[model samples]
Target: MFFNTFSWKEFLLRKIISLLTVLLLVVGCENNKKSLEPITPEDFLIIAHRGASAYAPEHTIPAYEIAQQADADYIEIDLQMTKDGVLVAMHDEKVDRTTDGVGFVIEYSLEELKQLNAGRWYNSANPGLANKEFEDLKVPTLQEIFSHFGNDVNYYIEMKSPKIYKKMEEKLVSLLIQYNLIRANGELPKVIVESFNEDSLTRLHQLEPKLPLIQLFYFKEEATLSVQHYNRLSNFASGIGVNISSVDNDFIQEVQLNGFQVYLYSINNEIEMKKALNLQANGAFTNNPDMGISVRTEFEK
Candidate 1:
């Protein structure tokens, strides 16, 4: 009886040990799999620069709708604050070029700005593709844009002239939270804040750590970034946007190696789009999103 009891005890012990060994092996395999996974550059993002500005007046509802049809990854909006502290989409500080209004955007109240003809300028500028529906398309407030698109589309928002608008960052964060964009979980939102101002970017990072930010750089001449510059930017920004002319294969590789995403901006043609792709840019901001999407699709094929 004693011998039988001992044999049974030994068998149970062996089974327990074998089960633990299998579990350990499984856990180790999972860890190894994760470790060995390649860090692929993010899937190419075709950001519509001011909502397919090539086809329609920029920063208007019509422009955004057309961008959606073109299958852009994100609708880029340049935010400028009005006198009444309303955030509106306008790329330039002055409204003379894009709208009938001939003053700084900040000088007009949102209501006054809405009264201006935002679309007529486009029709006049591009008579070849003019549409009657483009007439009287009012300047859209940032809130209006969010309400119109909701979670259906992603936003690449730029805090234009952050230094000029002292409370822009606070107001932006508040609006983002109000829109249910600030979540407790680490999941990325459909919004990304970008600016040429580092101070604004840093303030944004402080307000919402989970929200990704991009540092935008504009260069008249070709530019090269040092490791220190990449590291400094990485401290506050998840990625960098550069003029398409300023970036090359080495620049993209260096930035990616330092774990920062690189995006080339204002690429409106097939040749530049192909060059951006060849450099393995995470994305490119394009006035012609349709062209960018087509080139990307063909490249993938």
Candidate 2:
């Protein structure tokens, strides 16, 4: 009887060990599923600020072409008006900062704006990089950008001045339609329109409810306002676009909690670039698309 009892005990012990092993195997599979899950950074996009302005003068075909060559995911184009009320790709309402002109872009006709030396200012600080290879480069129209680089690159168009708010959405949508950028078959160019003037974006949303819109904010207390404003604007925006100084994981997380993405602007340095990635930002606007691409590639490795 003692011998029989010993056999039964040994059998029960073996069954308990086997059951524990099976449970562990099931738990291991569950853990693997969690570990192998996909993350956002894997598909994060890169936007070239002002058409890779670090390599060439901003908002010109030469600059945009460089952005494409650098493999940027999108080329940011800021829009302003010419005297004739035509939309042109430019950062400032005034041409004094980046061109050889002395007044507001709207003051000159397209013919007059085209004649100024757009490449002249580039030679002052970056002579070696300037070389005037693109000297006398003329300002390009919204239509011209689409004509020259259509469908080949994505665009991040910012309606710079709300003074043209009346015609801004109509003109932009018309051109995008002309170029077939807003696809009928669901192949749109992934255009993202941004503006500090919330009403401008709201207007676009009213016009084309499907187009992605971003709410841009810039303030002295940039970091603090980033969260507060993004929360308020989330009702109308798909994402938040703010100065690089304003981006942080906290802001990004807060934006994400509200079901919005984040795009940080004008980051050109290695430190800030790395910070953007570490924060898992949805995208970055950079003057050097090549630098952004290279660092992003390295970090993934």
Candidate 3:
């Protein structure tokens, strides 16, 4: 009886040790997998804010094409899903501001949203920059943008209102994989995912750990971030994008020191663009990619 009891204990102990060893090996394998490289100040990306929005209607194909022509590093796309579960590029949650249509983007099907003129409102608002060709410019689908540009241009895509579009992360990741934007063999993919919603970013990080992510911050009033905040963000994101007014030289230095890139948004004026360059921002989201590229050239020289 004593021998039998000892044999059972020995068997249990060996099984526990073997289980732990397997777990440790699995953990080691995971740790060995390479993480996506963080974007550094040396990158000096020129992101087109809604694709040269200063020249044409925001998120329209013409604007994106113009930005590509102007040599922007990445064309930013704000994504929202329509009623039929298709992704389209538009900044506002409702199409009223940018399109002749008046309704929530989620409320209308892609075909229904397409019926409304997207570019006429821009022409009316910016009279001096208006063009007849801008009339009846339709809202573009994400597929359309991908088809038109392919991998020739990089994309900085924002998951707008991810909470509202519950399946957006899944859908976006699927499309990226389908389009071969998620590369294998440790090469950097041209697509970057960004969002103000941390959960959305987290969901993307889980789905594709290799996909580079930028966490966006919108500041209504000026504020400074703590080291703790930067450290927490560094756990999941490769970079941060903030409203240009929210950042200073010290802020940029601190964030960069902590191994995260800083990108400032919507800098259209040359003076502001030059200031951003002086501050050594890793990138600037500009409505005029031509001006952004030119300023970067002069400043770097």
Off by over 4 Å in 2: 1-42, 183-189, 225-232
Quick one: best TM-score, which candidate?
A: 3
The residue pairs in collision within model 1 are none
Provide the lowest-lDDT 10-residue window in model 2: 32-41
What are the lDDT scores of the predictions, listed in order? Answer: 0.82, 0.77, 0.83
lDDT of 3 by residue, 32-54 (tens): 33365555335578999999999
**After TM-score superposition, what is the CA distance of residue 50 in candidate 3 from its true location, in Å?**
0.5
> lDDT for model 1, on a 0 to 1 scale?
0.82
Cα lDDT tens digits for candidate 1, 112-205: 8988999998899899989998998999998899899887777889999988786899998888888876542223347888899999998988
Index of the highest-lDDT prediction: 3
lDDT of 2 by residue, 217-300 (tens): 774664644334543454467777877776667556655655566888778987888888899888889999899999888878
Better of 2 and 3 by TM-score: 3
Please give the distance, in angstroms, between residue 9's alpha carbon in candidate 2 and its true position after superposition. 49
